[model samples]
Target: MASRWMWASQTIILLGAVFVLAGCEEQTNSAQETESAAVVSTPSVLASAGPVKTAEPQTPSMEQLVERYKGLELIDAHNHDASDSRYQSQLGLWKQTGLGRTVLFGDVSEPSAVGTDAVAWEAYLKYPDRVIPYFSGFDLHDPGCLQVIRGNLEKGYFGLGEIAVASTNSPVVSKVAWKANDPMDGYLPQIYDLIAEYNAPILIHLDPVGGEPLAKLEQALEEHPDTIFIFGHINAYNSPQETERLMAKHPNLYGDFFAGFTLYNPDGGGKAEPFLPVLKKYADRFMLSTDSGYGITEVRAIEAMYRVLDQLGDPVVQKNIAHDNLMKLLQAQPATQTQLKELRKQGAGGAGTEAAPQKLSKLEAGRLLAQAPKG
Candidate 1:
């Protein structure tokens, strides 16, 4: 009985040992599974905490952007300010359109009412900073005209006007009664001298009558290498050969695109096709201007001009024409400094002066018509 009891006890002990080993194996397997799960979760946590990579934002189109210039410092190389009301309206337009600086040329075509230094001075007083008055020596035959030009230069007028030496048969010049022998003929040399002395630029009305404009321009350039001459209203309708010839020969010569739409249209009188190739070739020497009158709105004119250029496939070039080129030119001049001083003094007297006028009297209109050379 003692031997049988001992055997049962040993069997019971073996079973207990087996149960202990199974529990140990199960615990080991559970720990391994938990460790594996932790390892997998660690990668996901690292990924969530890491720095994110993102793409750069795209640039906006030129049309989408507003004029980004900070101040009202635009140089309108060509503009007219004849009457007080017209001047105010145009001034408001400039302010509204974000054009801060303007160069006002008195009505050149006026017959009996030539723009005198006093008239220009009054206009300058109207919008000191905004308007830079340009003196026109239309009566170059008048010795007083030289005195006026000199006086205005000392007082800080921007430059001279749409002056022209009439070609033999330019209808435009002839209609305006602008004789080739008038003051401009004798005045040309003197004006060139004054420009060199003041380091100023002059705007010349150059429309080839009998294909001699290139020769005339060449001669002018040779005589006054230092004088900067801007050719007003480049032949928008002329043959491409003419444009190429003029641009290639004269480095000192520059051109403004205004009233070219009429000439550029094959069907007659509307928007011109994009002259991008020509524009690109002479990008540095060319500027965009609106010879728009007080009657026409500047916004509409600017929009139309931009639309034609936009088709050219380069927004940068358009931007340069719209503002950059003018800005660069204005910045280069010291006259801006004198103008600013006068503007500040004027502004101190009151809230600020209003814009100058751009109305044309009947006499002025007749003069402009008369000045149109016969071609």
Candidate 2:
């Protein structure tokens, strides 16, 4: 009887040990599965976004950069400020920021035109050298608009537009905005002819981008080869290569470098790789601006537009884009110090503008830029 009891106890102990080992194996497998699931769920930062921009890690504050661009004087190729009061308010900012002059225009794409065209003229009269005026009509096709434009030119307006060729205006606004139409259609042909006659540049705004709009713009460029066209916002928002291609094909085309898009990384590192080549190749074709990226003052606009060029650090290239090229377009040569002094006194009608180009030293030019406010 004693021997049978001992054998039974030994068998129970062996069975218990097997069950204990199995439970430990199951627990180990469960722990591993939990860890594997956690590993699969997490994501790296770049997983969602294809490739990150390798821009400069550090950037300069806007004010710290003011003197770095020692002699950059800007001719803002495009801007819209319907408020005539801005002319008085923003004047000092313009002077301090080295913005020598700017081109102001009324935008026709808005619901309320509110005599913006007239206001631009008024702004020019108040600060003639600081503000170059452009005439904007509700419809370029309007029969009497020709007389209005001619009158503006006589009043010393510089050009015509912020003209909306194709517009997709504010959908949320209760009223319908300016209708988007074919740029080459309507009375634009006659109007363009008149613009050429006056020797004024025309700034056209075409929208909904790509497809037919670009085609029509190209047609306008082809048809009116005599007229100088500022392709506002450059190749209408595509690769800089497209802007370069258009510029290469058309001698009369000029581009405004605004749009908050750049081939530059502001950190003093990372080249706006595609940008430098085109800018160097067609140095004379583009001018610096902040079209509707209007700072509180003209100088603010100049600084904002020039931030990229400042990072790039080529003073010669900066001079051509900011001053000399636009001077060529305006049919005005760079002024001498004595000439610059005289220019400050005279308005847009001054005769001194046609004088020979003088190489302005950085210190002298920077001083003159702030002081000489001629258009």
Candidate 3:
């Protein structure tokens, strides 16, 4: 993790990058109005997977939102390692913040990175279904790298990434950037082939901030369309329009809307409205995340994200960004998405009524915290 202490800090007033333009962002809300309505009217696919049960959309309780979406599983597509200080409280923190899952990665250049990977692995082992691990990019032939990769695959590591190639001040990022610029660097093309075979997505951090240097990233995307590539924050270094252009052109390029609105919005969360149209238009191509790490847990990011969801305000769109898109990345399947749509149309009477992720009881949390590795 970066040296900055406030990884996803709850206390920091997250005013995203200060470079936001002052002019009115183009609003395309109406462009997708017909498409949205069509989706709603599509007679949800009710199937052989038991009768569907969905509840009416009343006031949006955490549970109401869950049931309405049918077994809603909120996923944070980007996360760094938990700080040693926060290790014990991480799960509790997630519970409080309504985060069901977090895709975890770390800086690859650090020797200690493997330790962080171990920490993430422990969390994955403790909460198999909720924690998905993605390793940093490395030479496939490196015995050490492959050993860890193969071991984690057996233990359920999800994919490779949050890896990036951007010229940056951070030493770790610079190293990754170097690897990215070299065609033969770490023999990535061959590795990407293996990843494609495994059916796993790779999270990439391309631009240091603004991805002005899209040439490298674009090349990789065009070359490996079969390899799922998750670009960093949708709102970072690139305007929403640019992000949309990339998504529209490349079917394999995905983005995580990593709560940039929280810091960048003039009023905080509502800043996301301008991008909602694009988000809905390419619903399956995006996922929501806190991108919280270092010392910060996801508490603030998750809250800010839900606030955006509330303002954006379409249930199906919300579910897609929240979890459905991620499930596809996770399992390479959409059975959950289809089932969710059917149940949403049916009105979840009891299906997935549990609003938030099931939490560890107080005692359980305390016990785990006590036993949490102090690294």
Candidate 4:
């Protein structure tokens, strides 16, 4: 009996040992499987998903783009001189950017009298080479104004006013209070007469407040088919329709995009979209000017204009706005032939005749004259 009981106890102990060994092996295998799965899965996940991406670089702003073209030659079609100090400061800025020449329109608001012409002449004499003066008309209502216009023309003034004509009202009849009036009647004929006589262009400041000015413009176009006019301050056009209609109708009419930066958002908050097709359609007629009055320096104003052009897309358009169109207009002028000769002579030690001379084109002489300046 004792031997049988001992045998039973030994069997039970062996069974317990076997069970313990099996449990240990199962745990080892499970742990090994979990580690291997982690390694395999990690590599597959890493392979499928690459590293994170970073942002791209940025482009330069409009102002910076303009600064790049500093020291380039530019012609300002419209400018004014109110004071000597202001004039010098403006001219200095112009020199920095290679301002070739500026067309100065005298203060038209000068009370209509001999004093106005004298003041205009004095301003011209102050900066002869730097400025091409435009004589102001006497009151369109006064016959004597025509005589003053002719006298200034004889003196070599390029064209007519920074003329303030209200398209809404006739400044001629309503001389005292020329509020905006549509169907501009009183002054259109007289102005047209002077424009025709001189065969010179007139700069008109049309009212932007109402469509009245545009209506007056249309009437004027019908009356004077041959009249050449430049709409000063493109901001006055107000709406796209007026701009398109007038630009399409008048070959001789042009737009000056000066002060346009301000008028762009009269309400003070909106995008100033490019006059797109308007600029593209009449790129030839359109010209850029600072219209930077007495306060702003010429260089700063010119830089501002260039900044606007830089945002205009591509260098070609920028070059056209900066130089080409103005060059074309300058070349078209009858004075170019004589001007070139004088420039050549000035280049040489020879005296550049101050007065405007008659047409003299001797190719050989001109060529020699050109060389003398360089030598």
- Which pairs of residues collide in model 2? 94-299, 263-272
Which runs of model 3 end up more than 4 angstroms from their true locations?
A: 3-71, 83-87, 137-151, 169-172, 175-179, 182-184, 208-212, 261-270, 293-297, 333-375
Q: What digit string (tens of lDDT, one per residue) describes model 1 on residues 297-346?
A: 34433433443444444656655665566555544444323333444444
Native-referenced Cα lDDT, model 1: 0.48
Error of 3 at 270 (Å): 7.2
At residue 108, candidate 2 shows an lDDT of 54
Candidate achieving the largest lDDT: 3
Off by over 4 Å in 1: 1-75, 83-85, 109-120, 142-144, 167-173, 177-184, 259-274, 293-299, 312-315, 335-375
Q: Which ten residues in a row have the lowest lDDT in candidate 3?
A: 44-53
Better lDDT candidate (1, 2): 2
Q: What residue pairs clash in candidate 4, if any at all? A: 168-181, 168-182, 169-181, 347-373, 348-373
Query: Count of backbone clashes for each model?
Result: 36, 2, 18, 5
Over 1-375, each residue of candidate 4 has an lDDT whose tens digit, in order, gives 010000011110101111111111222343234333433332111111111112123433323434466434556777754322234334434543445666665444235423434544544454444455565546655566566666665444566756666632323323323222443544556767665654567766655425666667777777787777777755433555567777898776877766324322223112234464566666677777766431233333454465455556656666676666655543333433444455555654233323433332222223333344233
Computed on alpha carbons, the lDDT of every model, listed in order, comes to 0.48, 0.54, 0.54, 0.49
Of the candidates numbered 3 and 4, which has the greater lDDT value? 3
Ranking by TM-score: 2, 3, 4, 1
